[model samples]
Target: MPLSEFGDAWPGGVPVQAHGMDADPFFAGEGDLGFARQVVESAERGELFLYPGDQHYFADPTLPSYDPDAATLLLSRTPAFLGVVS
Candidate 1:
């Protein structure tokens, strides 16, 4: 769905967590950062945003693009996010 749909569906607000890397090849050619910024800007009251910066930071450990520290940080923070959203 489009980002506008998200804005329309949950007028109250929603917690959002976005993870991306500046050097990620997949996003390099696209406007991912711009889109993400829009989402963060449009976020409702109390919403959240999270982005880990590294080339393909969220990739699995088996992937060369994976960043251990970033992944660990994301893992540690995830539980808190779940709590907040819940």
Candidate 2:
């Protein structure tokens, strides 16, 4: 896609995390995982890329697909992934 045209634009690399499910049929699709993988593969080497498995937006406590375990792991790892320490 157009992303291929912007290869030089991502000199710093990219970090992204998405709900790993097609819960929102309108917004999410099976292609998401594939796209994420493509992004990671295409990114600069030795940079950071994270995709917490099986985690989705509904992973929050009040949501329907709320997965406490997955949420916990995702939340815990996000900071380090972003290189944020406090």
lDDT of 1 by residue, 26-66 (tens): 55437666566666556663333344454754657988777
User: What TM-score would each prediction reach against the true structure?
Assistant: 0.66, 0.58
lDDT of each candidate versus the true structure? 0.61, 0.53
Q: How much lDDT does candidate 2 score?
A: 0.53
The top-ranked prediction according to TM-score is: 1
Candidate 2 — which residues are off by over 4 angstroms?
A: 5-10, 16-29, 45-55
> What is the C-alpha lDDT profile of model 2 across 3-74, one tens digit per residue?
465563335555544435434442245455455555555656323233334435645798776767766766
Model 2: number of clashes?
1
Model 1: residues >4 Å from true position, as ranges? 1-11, 45-54, 84-86
Q: Considering only N, C-alpha and C atoms within 3 Å, which residue pairs clash in candidate 2?
A: 19-56
Cα-based lDDT at residue 43, candidate 1? 62
